[model samples]
Target: MSFFKSLFSKKQPTARPKLNHPSELQLNDIFTFGDSFALPEAMRKQQLQVVDINTLEFQHQHYAQIVGQGSGQQLVYVSFPNNPKKLIKLSLLLSRNEVEALFDLDAFSEIFEEPGNARLRPLTKQHIYADMIADEYIQEEFMISGYSHQQDYRGTQPPQYTEDQHGREFEYHCLEGGAGERSVDIFIFENGDTDVYLSFLRPANEITELWMKGE
Candidate 1:
């Protein structure tokens, strides 16, 4: 009886290490990076189509989009022009409510780590959310991958600011990594709404070369 009980006993779940920064989460483990886009056999049966960005007139120039037939499923492909292998695929299955809530200050800022350490001060509503649309996307799409709860911190001190013809701009770099790197740039504008640019930069050397050469 004792032997049988020991054999059938349940094991406790192992705790994940406490993460201090977004840079500690690895993007590559959850999503395929630096690879050609291929629909899963199941998804292929649903009629996949590569939509031209020009037809959609997407404001963001860095990513290319692909859509599924009638399914609300979509993939955003990030790659250098003429180079297909070095790519990051962002899978999106967003609801209307989630999309609208992204622009809300409280909803958008919820994903960032709350400040507590002596070295870190609590972030203001504007500073906490600031141009962080990527947080919403990740929360909605990648939550199952365990990145939704990861801590994110400013990669640069004081952030960065600039002025352009349109308006004043504030830029902040938030990053997470362990197995791979995921870097995001949040661009806050005085006259316009915020914008987010996310990059999965694992296997860094190759990506750096491709980016530097404007490939």
Candidate 2:
């Protein structure tokens, strides 16, 4: 990874800014990884102390050692039960704080993510980082379902559908989840993404008519 040595320099480890999401945080804004601002709303209510800091000579990188105890909503996939915190490399900026870190979304995921739990579904990388998608429909659906009843059929996993008649097969690659109010069905086709319920939740023949008309 390229270093931004000119942007930030190391500062006192005791100094840090509280942040929720760093979307609006300017490039110059600085904070330590252990600060409560770097934590999720629920995780912040509990103790997330910075116990140690270590560095690697090979990569010329420093990482923070954190320990979090107590309990609250499990927003992250990883659990912190007397959880020996994950060590993540701090980015190098030209500021006066070499120890200071930016706990942005990617950094935040690394801390909460467990080893070897990645790559469950290669097609769903965004879901892995809890990242956002631009399609508003799928976004809203994910908000409702929260990965529950999730279905994946991309990469090596082919669509499970047995129906002989079908349009563009990419529509078959989907993530269907939940039911009732907490429900979402998204199809990531070659051309674009669309809600399954919107595009294909009708009689096969009726779907054919609409699909042909759209084509």
Candidate 3:
């Protein structure tokens, strides 16, 4: 009788971790300084289209414009507070041939783990475009692959301004968020005192589709 009771017992749900600042979070290489330089941006403007993906009910209504093709090609450009004069973009574009290359490289794996930590594989440009067609595409292929989102400090990367408060600038990638739920926030600051603020949160799925269809 006790065994039967145990079999029917409900297990407790694990607690969610608290969000900390600067540190206290584990990050993956892709979210770090692993950008393909201008590769992502160039592909979006040339090979794939761009869109805005922000429609999740629970996500914060932050303005993000996602541009890319639904055929697994696109780039994500984010413009946020502090330095609102510039746009920071991240892109991924993969051609049919490129997809074949991935297979050749043995890049397809159900699980990615190191000695003691799980890792997320870097996306081929092709992977980025496919993600736009369906949120599920990237969600299943990349998001769920045990990779952590990046945390970009206040200042890093291009469009960065000179110090002394004359202007703002940040051009670097870092890790952010918790396991299973993570994101990469790229920063691009223009000259000081520019007026540009994005307050709409969008899901990448829909935005990428629109851009691909050229709508």
Clashing pairs in 1: 22-175, 22-176, 23-175, 23-176, 23-177, 24-177, 25-177
Q: State the TM-score for model 3.
A: 0.24
Off by over 4 Å in 3: 1-63, 68-87, 95-97, 103-107, 112-215
Q: What C-alpha lDDT values do all the predictions have?
A: 0.30, 0.23, 0.28
The 10 consecutive residues of candidate 1 with the worst lDDT sum are: 142-151
Give the per-residue lDDT of model 2 (tens digit) for 104-205: 334223322333121111222233112211122222222121111122111123223356522233322122222211112233344554322211111111
Cα deviation of 16, candidate 2, in Å: 16
How does model 3 fare in lDDT? 0.28
**Which order, best to worst by lDDT?**
1, 3, 2
Ten-residue segment with the worst summed lDDT in candidate 3?
22-31
Better lDDT candidate (2, 3): 3
With candidate 2 superimposed using the best TM-score fit, by how many Å does residue 20's alpha carbon deviate from the native? 17
Q: Candidates sorted by TM-score, descending order?
A: 1, 3, 2
TM-score of each: 0.26, 0.17, 0.24
Assess candidate 1 and give its lDDT: 0.30
lDDT of 2: 0.23
Q: Pick the TM-score winner.
A: 1
* Local accuracy of candidate 1 as per-residue lDDT tens digits, 49-126: 333221111122222222222234444332221224443333333243533433454544554434311111113324
